[model samples]
Target: MYVVFFYQGLATHLSAKKSALEQLDGYRLRLRKSEEEFHHKEDERHVVAETLKKANAENSVKTAVESDGEEEDEEDADAGSEEDGSRGYTPSPTPAKSRAGSHVSPT
Candidate 1:
């Protein structure tokens, strides 16, 4: 009778150890899944940040182009005014003025 009880107790202890090992395995699997989810979310965030940076750079280039065009137009207008100012007008000589100046001699 004593030997039978000792064997039964040993079997019970082994069964309990097996149940604990199964629970630990389940917890380990859950932790791995959570870590994978965290990495996936981090990758998505990086992609979004890169896209936004590209968009902002494109917008800045477009703004610079538009500003350069406006400056060129202003310069063209100023050059046209300067050209007009440089050309002075001259009056034509009349027939009476030519006849009077023809006989005039300085001594």
Candidate 2:
């Protein structure tokens, strides 16, 4: 009877230990899954951030190019106007050439 009781007690203790180990394993698995999810989220955030940065840089370059084109167009228009003005205006005769052999007569 004493031996039987001892054997039963030992069996019960082993069963309890098995249950505790199973619980610990389940907790470890949950922790590992949570860690994997965290890493995935971090990678996604990095990708999004990189994409936004690239888009902003592209937009800035486009804006700079457009502004430069506008400045060039304005300069071209100013040059054209200057050319037109030069072509349309004639210089007046110089005073010395106009009075080369002329004497003023009293009236």
Candidate 3:
């Protein structure tokens, strides 16, 4: 009778151990899946961030080019106005005389 009770106890212990091992395996699988999802999301975020940086750089370059073009246009307009002299305004001769007078050495 005692031998039968010992055998039953051993069987029960083995069954419990097997159940615990299965639970541990299930938990490990869930953790691995969660980690994989997190990595995937991180990769996507990096890609988007890089894309945004590139777009911003391109926009800044375009803006700089446009600003330079505007400056050149304004310079051209000023030069054109000066050459045509259609505004009925004559430039003063005093500035040229002053520059020449300054070059004369005082004896």
Clashing pairs in 2: none
Q: Best-fitting candidate, measured by TM-score? A: 3
lDDT string, candidate 2, 9-54, tens digits: 9999999999999999999999999999999999999999999999
lDDT of 3 by residue, 1-107 (tens): 99999999999999999999999999999999999999999999999999999999999999999999999998887778778984445677674445645575789
Model with the higher TM-score, candidate 1 or 2:
2
What are the root-mean-square deviations of the candidates from the true structure over C-alphas?
A: 10.4, 8.1, 7.0
Per-model TM-score, in order, reads 0.67, 0.69, 0.72
Candidate 1 ranges with C-alpha deviation above 4 Å: 86-107
**Global CA lDDT of candidate 3, please?**
0.91
Q: Which ten residues in a row have the lowest lDDT in candidate 3?
A: 95-104
| Clashing residue pairs in candidate 1 (N, C-alpha, C atoms within 3 angstroms) | none
Q: Is candidate 2 or candidate 3 better by TM-score?
A: 3
lDDT of 1 at 27: 99
**Which pairs clash (backbone N, Cα, C closer than 3 Å) in model 3?**
none
The local lDDT score (0 to 100) that residue 68 gets in candidate 3 is: 100
Note the clash tally of each candidate.
Answer: 0, 0, 0
Residue 11, candidate 2: how far off, in angstroms? 1.9
